[model samples]
Target: MLIMNRKRMVEDKLDRLTKGQTAYAESRELIRLVKREIQNRQIPVLMDETDSGCWFIPQKNTTTPSDEQLAQM
Candidate 1:
């Protein structure tokens, strides 16, 4: 329930913001905010823009490489 509420809130804010801005400006701002929100929440998903629209893919693992792993490479 909490997660759904938060998701709805974020979606609502995005909708309201984009609705008030010009098309290209809104697109860029939405992209920037979405990136920031993803980082802030450590969302386990990846997003990208394609010819069709935004593509969201689930991430199996989002772990950062440790020093040992980096050293092995």
Candidate 2:
């Protein structure tokens, strides 16, 4: 679980920016990247639980992602 203060990241990126307007743009990109990574990690847990037919109450419903996405995950 990677937790980050987006405001801080934005400020830092902005501080370092030589070409961009603000840090928010860079921060948004970083967030998108982080989100994609987290989602990638989650697929296996979801697959494993679903494959095993485990009664994981919190994750009652499971639907597999597409093959290409699954491969990337």
Candidate 3:
């Protein structure tokens, strides 16, 4: 299939690119760049799952009312 061929081509090119570099260094750099790109793309499902814990804070605690505390008046 066309998709399979393209995947093969990309794999080939990546293999060629890393062939000259040391295995450990090349693999570490490749992993870092791939993770950076994935983060930059900001995929919704990935973003939600990655941030599910920290981004969800209680709505009432998000804002403080200075007027209620007699500070704004």
C-alpha positional error of residue 26 in candidate 1 after TM-score superposition, expressed in Å = 7.6
Instruction: Give a tens-digit lDDT track for model 1, residues 11-68.
Output: 6544443344211112454555655665676655556565544544445565899999
* lDDT of candidate 2 over 1-73, digit per residue (tens): 9988765654444333323222222244554543344355442222112332321111223577999989998
Residue 31 displacement in candidate 3 (angstroms): 0.2
lDDT of 3 at 65: 56
TM-score of each: 0.38, 0.25, 0.25
Per-model C-alpha lDDT, please? 0.51, 0.39, 0.32
Model 2 misses residue 73 by how many Å?
A: 59
The per-prediction tally of clashing pairs is 0, 0, 0
lDDT score, residue 57, model 3? 14
- Model 2: lDDT equals 0.39
The lDDT-based order of candidates, best leading, equals 1, 2, 3
Using lDDT as the measure, which candidate wins?
A: 1
Candidate 1 residue spans exceeding 4 A from truth:
1-9, 12-26, 51-53, 60-73
Measured with C-alpha atoms, the lDDT of residue 22 in candidate 2 is 24
Better of 2 and 3 by lDDT: 2
Candidate ordering by TM-score (highest first): 1, 2, 3
